[model samples]
Target: MTSHSFSKFWSTDLTRDSLLSLLDTPTLKSLRLVNRAFAATTSRQLFRDVYITFRSSTFTKPARMAALERIGWNIRSVTFVINHGAEMFLPPLLDPLTGEEVCFVFTPCVRTTTPTSSPTAPASGSTSTAAGERQGVYGTWEMTDLLVKQYPPLFHAAMNVSSFVAALTHMPALRHLKVSCAGQESTHRYRRSVVDYALSSLRIAIEQAPLPRLEALSLTPIHPGGIQYLCPMAGIGSLPNSCRRWTQIRRLEIHMDTFPFDKGQATDHLKLLHSYLQAFRALRDFKFRWVGDGHKGPSPLSLATEPALCELASRSQACPKTRHYLRPLKFPYLQYMVLGNAVLDASQVSDFLTEHRHSLLEFDFEQVSLRSGTWDDALAPWRTLSSAEYDAAWGEKQPAEVEVMEVPFVLGPSPEESPATSSPEQYSKRRKKKKKKRHARTTEVAVNNDLFASTAAMLLEEEPVHRGSLNFRTLREGLSNWARSKGMFWGHGHGHGHGSSHDYLHKAVQSPILV
Candidate 1:
């Protein structure tokens, strides 16, 4: 067929399934640019999943805004990197796609630099720069400042430090919000003063406006020290009143670097965790990681589980209306649970798995040591059958009439060697020479014995019983003949063989055979 004719025929003959398959191929991208008809059809397929690469030097804020604006309102998902200023980038991306449910990923730029300082360098004069700092100044953007300056309402409405969250207040279709800060400095900046300021500002802004539709919030703060600051107990007291607006939040993940539970200020931390659970009654999944030094502390969930502190856990049982919080803990709704060096007693882990095992699909335990008896108690219920029963159920088929045999050999000093009393030096030299000869002879005898025993066992186990056919006398004579041919001892009980058969068996068992 002619090229034009083939093209026309293929296009007309393509089914919906075939068209989708064709579009998935790498060649389709080039094919789409061939003609307007191909372009129009392929544009829909290409734009269905919107992916923006922020690392490209060509991709500026305005260009990104224009590209997103041009994609129309049909874009469903977006994956983008925010090297330095996610605050500036996220608002516009979110602003144009308010009607559609979107997923926003913020990945920090990877640092690429070699260390130049020695470990012994003086603290004051150390010239080494942090990995994040080595990425240049423009590579870092304060998330709180970026939000405050750009998207104030979404920031305020979502209880995020960034003002950019304001952009989502009116976005009823907003479903997923993921924010991650990179490195310790960024985390410190976010938690120390930025997060508090942002939240405080957001509270004020939300009081002016509210987000009734936002559902899922995932915040990963990389600063270990920032978690205590972000999830402060005192802050929890104020959040109960101010956070009444986020009634729709169902999934929350607060990833931190350090959760200082031993700082004697954990009462507020406990209260804040409880308050979040209380505020979001619709919540189904909650995860928290203790990033601080893992010293055992008062359970954050203890207070929340308490009837006095958390009125939610107390009043209802089925689909309880009260707050349900899992602090470095697992829950029934948890389809995926990652217990990272959590200080949970064996019973707690057992209880959690028992309640959630039916629904739990993925479980990860990192640096999570189980207490004694925990494993047996947790897994014993799963092992219903004994080893024999289990083998009968699932064991592979075995061939009939398998033979097994046992044989023993003994090693003794050479007949030529004489026992004698001598000087210390003479005795030492003689002992050394005897030790080497003994080792060599023992190894040779052990190897020969194993081969003979294994051959006998196999023959006995596999051969059918012939009337009066199997005889030890004939077997011994044949072995002696074979040993003579192979340059091994063949005489009647040479060396250690002069001892009892039981003694020979002991030597055979004790001798070390090198493979």
Candidate 2:
């Protein structure tokens, strides 16, 4: 077909959305070869969110970037991810139940930077092209200078900090910037310390850049097969200088999987948090997630999994008290705050709420505990929830919220790794003892639930009274009256709920804890 005729035919053949949908990376390259119109359309789509990975062998980045700069204004976000690995860094296989490393495989490091040392070669078994490219990039004066200035020992480490800053300075429309340091240490060429240095250098570079349009920032680490050890609070304390320039930033999230849970580290975190809240005056939403549980499992090895940290156990170990108190800080524009797996005391929580109550619309307390001095003190916050106010506020359009707070009232014994005696007779006896203990715990849970229900019925009365005048029947009648008044049915587990002993005991066991 003639060029003009072909252009006209393709343009009329597919709609914009349909045309764009058909253009994956390989397909886009194929389409670009077809005609000028196809090339223009494909180029626009490909350059929308420019991605640059320094170590990938798939394509030459400098060449690709030169192509994108011609249409750089079309780009909205720039993502820079550095991959590094150290010779001694081994991936861990975790225990299913406890999340601890069950075994580890140690292997000799492979030299990836040197082309001749690479495992794969070209179809013709030639090495000149690959070696030339590697040497050209690494041997460049600019690249060597960058490596020496930022990360000296880790030459293969992706030191794109200065490049990122330079890139950010040029891109006027870029609003989102994500820089991640993950799996950066490779087998043969690795520097464990350089990872932090690289990350810190990246932050410093960002500080030097002026990005007024930048709105969202995510600085995270990605570790393959295992959990990442996040940068310390001291390293994060450097952000105020960088973030001060980010006035338009409305959303800020930082994930530190390796934050220590000791009292001293907790103090440091609180200090950092205060500084952040004070710094981001225009921030509308803030989220801080520390201590990532590896493999999303109930990691007994994690300090976050300890009963003392989250109040997970009914009987908790006494923690060394800290006399230090959190000073009040305000976030006038912050609408939402999420502090995942973070433990704060009642006073600290109250202070946070009071400071941000004007603009704070939502908060998440996932794995969060508000440690109170006493049970009554803990319940004091909910004591003033007026039924009249609730009735008025909840309507057809806005529904009242019902939360089922799960409190662990009974904790089973921790599983033993192995029996002390290896004898078959002793092992058999141990197994039997363990089974009996498990059954006993189940029975104990049932008894505890029944006791709690009877206590709630007596104590949680509509008309408050002293212990002498406590009445369960009156409380039941009051609950029934309120249910009828609300035009809601209260189920006594007659038809829908099984009335068998197994089900009854289950209800009696689950009610106090689950409800």
Candidate 3:
């Protein structure tokens, strides 16, 4: 194919999807080399999702600012990593006509460096010069302050993330919003106040913002505390009246390093979960990850299956709410349910499935052990029980019971002969007679050894039968014949045979049975 044809085919068929997979660095460089059409396509892919790490200085200050200016306007999702009390500066809105507002925003960070200390100071004469050098150290800080003061609106507006979210309220296309900090654990300790403030402000913004198309909301913690505080904030009592009005959210993911496992903690966690369920009638997907010290494992609170489920049933029965509100509140819309170290017994599992079996697509039970007989039988029993509960609650008839069958094992005769009437001497005589018969057969075979002319013929006669009952002589003859066919002899020093009947029978019986 011609290069032009190849390029066109690649761009149209392959590159469109492939470009989305490119990382930030490669995508940016590719845009410069490509034409307008290619650049536009690649730019959308590059700016579709933006991730900012607060801990990394490279991504935090200058590099991140440049990236935001280049693509932040078109970004559908933004995840922040706030750390070290360093605030992120917002990029100035691009002016299509002038393009003069595009200026870099420089934010200074503290860095400590130590120069080699002189053994002898140059007396008081050099103290002033040293003091001047120290003063120069504060130059960057002053410059940052001056810039903040000069552009109060830009700096202040950016500092209050609520306003930024408010601006995004009219963005009908916006779908996902994620806020996080820098260090996974340490950030929680140092930036807890900042995160709490940001979340509180965002909550207000979300309440007031015109988000008619929002779908997913994720609160991922850069520090451990972010997750720790999120659940409480979403609890029934803790959530603001306005916050509970978000009825359009469908997916929520809360990732934290610690979750309260005690009864008090569990109560708070459940309350938070209940509040979310009550508020977001459209929620379908839920995920929460709890991280804690290895020494201190998960919480030990047991969920009350009967009372809790009974309450839900009562509410559903009494409420005459519309299908739109009811549908979201119903367990049937739950597509994915994941319980990590949560006390979910068999009854709870059955109750949950009973309530929403039709909507449940994926269910995961981690670090939770069920009762021994909980699922020992077919899963149908559990399903039936759940169905029964639903039917009873709705005043319907119960299903018929299922019959299960059990099979018994059969035993054969023992190796010992029955001695109801026979004496010991009679049994000994019977054994001797059998031995004599076997000896007679061996002597007859030796006498007729010369009947066959060829060695192969002799070997064939010596070969033992593989089926039915056989004695020691038969096994010995079989082995002898097999060795001779391979140019070997029974009396040769190369091969030695152990003569243990018990061992031979054990080996034969232990071999695999191929049907």
Candidate 4:
């Protein structure tokens, strides 16, 4: 018996596909050198999906970007990792009298051969113009922005949104995009300035090169839960129109720190983020997540009422002329959505689902809630019992009703095209309305909350959290009963590799369940 050559077997279509699937990036790159045929095959796959980082040694940003432009045509999926590098700091300014460093600065200063000094400068340098013939200056010079924008990946992810867009311009064929920021923390002093600049420059770059082909996008910021007050104190008009450039997008995921204020009523951030969310009208899949502790983030609050969120509702912003009116976040074509650690109004969520009932298939509330209404309100569809009172329940909607209709006698091949019969062909009127059709739809919302987070937080903080609600809603026994009571199907959190029963008892906050 004759055996087939290994080369011949390896060249088979099945074998090639298996090889590509099994091999890692390095192996594939090396295999390309085996022959010209392999080279052509591997080259396309090699760059089809790429993950690039801009972190340590970010000085090579230009070279990487250039290389991206070269291989961009082959890239369809890319993840751009932005590093919140070690604190961006500058040398402390020396006291002119003492010549000893006084304070460190985050803002960069300009260099000069012979520069004028500030009488009371933003920079820490002295006002003595005669101090040096070169490089000793103090004025209202903000060099941090210029440098940060120049190499966005080296800074915080929240600080360089457009750098992602700029990189996107290179890949006209790009489809799936993920921009994540996770690195060393920066001082609080620079966050507001850098983030403000980032937010301000968002529109110009996007309008310059809208990645029309983009279908899926994920924006994640790995910053700690604290220090979410990154928004500018002044009005930074963030509107839904900012993202209209990508309305054609199908999937979107956003991970934000929290509402703008550290502890107060700040609707501007909420409105702006809402605008960002409302912009995606054509989305089919969406996720909105807030990084919080114990899944005990508070519900929405008002200027007058004390905020359960952020521990205070005292923070306020000037009522700019561009202040936004709260509206239901509409996504008519949405299919699946996940809300992780989110704070939303019941009516907003209910109306959002009701308006697009025909399109939405799956909805999840992970380590969060549906916020259907206040705990004491009898009319609520779903409610969380909390020590703090929440917004009134979303008034009940008319019970879901089924609508029936009649279809044509001959629906035809594709329903869009049916050959026009010549005068020779005829059909009976009785057959025209014989086929009846019925249509009805249901919205599924899975609320997976940490039933015990409140109890834990009570120990660490002064406030009290609602505990019994999750026991009746999210826990397996309660959830199963809730589902069966509502005439809906329910499933436990168990899986092929699920944690032990004790884990469920101990860390209920981390689990995600569906109904």
Taking every candidate in turn, the Cα RMSD to the unseen true structure, in Å, is 27.5, 32.6, 26.0, 31.1
Q: Judging by TM-score, tell me the better candidate of 2 and 4.
A: 4
When sorted by TM-score, best at the front, the candidate numbers are 4, 3, 2, 1
In terms of TM-score, the best-performing candidate is: 4
Candidate 4 residue spans exceeding 4 A from truth: 1-15, 55-66, 89-167, 183-190, 193-206, 222-244, 259-267, 298-324, 343-348, 370-515
> Can you write out model 1's per-residue Cα lDDT over 395-468, one digit (the tens) per residue?
43366897898878787765444355456677688899989977876776666666566655555666546413
Clashing residue pairs for model 3: 82-181, 257-291, 261-299
Displacement of the residue 506 alpha carbon in candidate 2, Å? 96
Per-candidate TM equals: 0.38, 0.45, 0.46, 0.49
lDDT, each prediction: 0.45, 0.48, 0.47, 0.48
For residue 312, model 2's alpha carbon misses the true position, in angstroms, by 26
What tens-digit string does per-residue lDDT give for candidate 2 at 1-515?
Answer: 89898567657636654676666888777876787766777766666676665443212245544554576665667776655555323334344457665432111121223222122222133577544443443454334343344333232332334343444555667677766655443232222343443455455445565655778766565332111222222343244344465556788776544434453223233344344445456888877665455412111112222333344323234753533333345567877777666654555555455555546667676676544454345334334435654333232245669999988798655445355426678789879998997786566545534544565554445335443464555544554344334432223322333345345444443443223
Q: Which 10-residue window in model 2 sums to the lowest lDDT?
A: 295-304
Query: What's the ranking of the predictions by lDDT, best on top?
Result: 2, 4, 3, 1
Estimate the overall C-alpha local distance difference test score of candidate 2. Answer: 0.48
Instruction: State the lDDT at 408 in candidate 4.
Output: 66
RMSD of 2: 32.6
The per-prediction tally of clashing pairs is 22, 9, 3, 2
